[model samples]
Target: MDNIIKANQFIQEGKLEEAAKILNEAIQENPNDTVAYVNFGHLLSIIGEKERAIAFYQKAIEIDQTMATAYYGAGNTYYDQEMFEEAVGMFKEAIANGLVEADAYFMLGLCYYNLGNLPHALANLLTATEKNPTDIDAMFQYGLTLAQTEQVDEAISVLEKVIKLDENHADAYYNLGVAYAFKEDIEKALASFEQALKIQPGHLLAGNGKKQLEALL
Candidate 1:
């Protein structure tokens, strides 16, 4: 089997040191292999070697300017470091290079959300959900962005979808309660909050929401 494949199997089997050794040897044997470089970068990132991961991603980019995975890997590292602006640039580059994964769009949305660009964040998150309807995180973010933009009804609908996707999604239930409260549907809001707390005992937001609803009643 190929060294990259073997390394990937090792990684899946939780043998990080073996995987790292194989990847390192593969890089040394084929320095120009962009895929190997990107995979190695991802492994390094998982092990908390953020700087080294970015360096490997940069090396992959140097070898193949059109390597979208390399750009996306580097963007993820930047995001982890809280460098939202740099992450936005790299994610956009990945998109421009034809990386159409939901994760790329989701990360771009998160970057825009972090930068307080609500419209752009909504747009990207909406696209991410469109690309992968089953991605609960993307759906949750899309719902949250809608709520932030004051689209309360739409936010409720999206949050409901998230709840359907994962019944135990406490944050979705809490956000749904918030949306219902914004619409002055006090009874529904209280019920949603109760559901959230039921799923995640002692959820602070759910508890607060329930208290506020009770006071209103």
Candidate 2:
């Protein structure tokens, strides 16, 4: 419990290095403590050492095959690295291993989107949004995927919902502008671009959108 307590304190203080040190020592002292390895992996991830994090997570999984969190972490690491196929495989394995979480679905959606598997991405993201409708990232990503698939109306609806939920969501407004432009609704497009610019001044995409709209006007 000493190591665990120290690790917790380090994490709470944002001392990820100290936490990883303590967790690594704990793992060395007790290699069977898969939780320590998993937490260490998570700490490494926070510090942006993705490959090391994946290795740590894999070590935990090797020691305890039933460590679903390890699989989930590995999946996220793969996804972050843009290894969509591998990420998809790992996330699916996590789900099959009963690692049910809104985040898992969200990650799966992202992987599918990156893989250009629009239908699967849409389905997974729909589940994520349903689980946590307030998830700004999920809503924005889902809307983007919908727009990519030519569902401009649906994309606008989702992006609008995101903007309503998080008024400062500049990306949502920017994407909504794109959706409106795709739908040939110049007025709505202009309004959405303005909204984005108001929230995030100098937002390049929104600025470009405004410029393009002005030309048409």
* Candidate 1 least-lDDT 10 residues: 1-10
lDDT against true structure, model 2: 0.89
* Tens digit of per-residue lDDT, candidate 2, span 1-217: 6888889789889998788788878988998888898788878887789999999999988988878888998898887788889889889988888887778999999999888899999999999999899898998899999999998889888988997898899999898888888888999899999999999998999999999999999
Over 4 Å off, model 1: none
lDDT of 1 by residue, 1-217 (tens): 3889999998888899999899888888888988889989999998999999999999999999999999999999999999999999999999999998899999999999999999999999999999999999999999999999999889988999999999999999999999888888898999999999999988999999999889978
> Best candidate, lDDT-wise?
1
User: Which model scores highest in TM-score?
Assistant: 1
The per-model lDDT (C-alpha) reads 0.94, 0.89
Question: How accurate locally is residue 88 in candidate 2, as Cα lDDT from 0 to 100?
Answer: 93
